[model samples]
Target: MFSKACEYGIRAAIYIGQQSAELGRRVGLRDVAAEIDSPEAFTAKVLQQLVRAGLLTSVKGPTGGFELTAQQLATVTLRQIVVAIDGGDMLQGCALGLPQCSAQQPCPLHYQFLPIRDQLNEVLRTHTIGELAGKVHDGLGFLKQFT
Candidate 1:
């Protein structure tokens, strides 16, 4: 459902949220990478991208780290992070890399996949990261822990 970049972006964002919730403080890239089992350099690069995209903030000095602004952390959607890292429609693209995929000339997977894709997209669009966190917290037994 997501590329490596999108996966890392979402994981890093969630890690930030979880760490902030636990420590009541921002988390650094090294710590986040360790927590999430992501490559340190790659995670740092993604963090930089998120910072540029206004989804995260970084502080410098002895206490330096990355933290999402209140609005960015609360109101931003998973879809936004995925799109920021992977573009608007990873799922909507050609499954076989065909350029002219559509209703008139659908790709191999398109006919069987469009409805599911649309449903998933709708779900992603409706949920914010804060809402997702609330759900995860409420359903921790059923939800998978990432880091």
Candidate 2:
């Protein structure tokens, strides 16, 4: 699971990447928020975090907006975004929120959760923004819920 900001951050990145790669254009904050169905203020804050993390670029003029370079789209992984917004503990935190929940002092579900957590970490580390955006561009994935 991810924090609300992290969830929106991921969606915003995917939408921005999809637009940039498919249409070759930068997306304004309003457009990004609309596409991802997130509040403009919250999305702006999340975007700021991504921008600070070097996963996104922002400009200020009328034609200015947000975008990721081709290199960034190709190289920025979900893990990076998650860490940027949620911190490195997103994947490493104990499932039960215990202060000491490691193998030596395992929580009730620590052993059972280890494999699942490892798998999730692997997936996040390997999946790129470009790959996910490409899926949306190809109509195989979506960034927003459909009614």
Full-model lDDT for every candidate: 0.75, 0.94
**How does candidate 1 score on lDDT?**
0.75
Clashes of 1: 0
TM-score, candidate 1, is 0.83
**What does the lDDT read for residue 5 in candidate 1?**
68
Give the runs in model 2 whose Cα sits over 4 Å from its true position.
none
Instruction: Write model 2 residue lDDT over 43-88, tens digit each, in one string.
Output: 9999999999999989889899999899999999999999999998
* Deviation of model 2 at 61, angstroms: 0.8
Estimate the lDDT of model 2.
0.94
**TM-score per model over all chains:** 0.83, 0.97
lDDT of 1 by residue, 4-46 (tens): 7678888778767655654568887788888767899999888
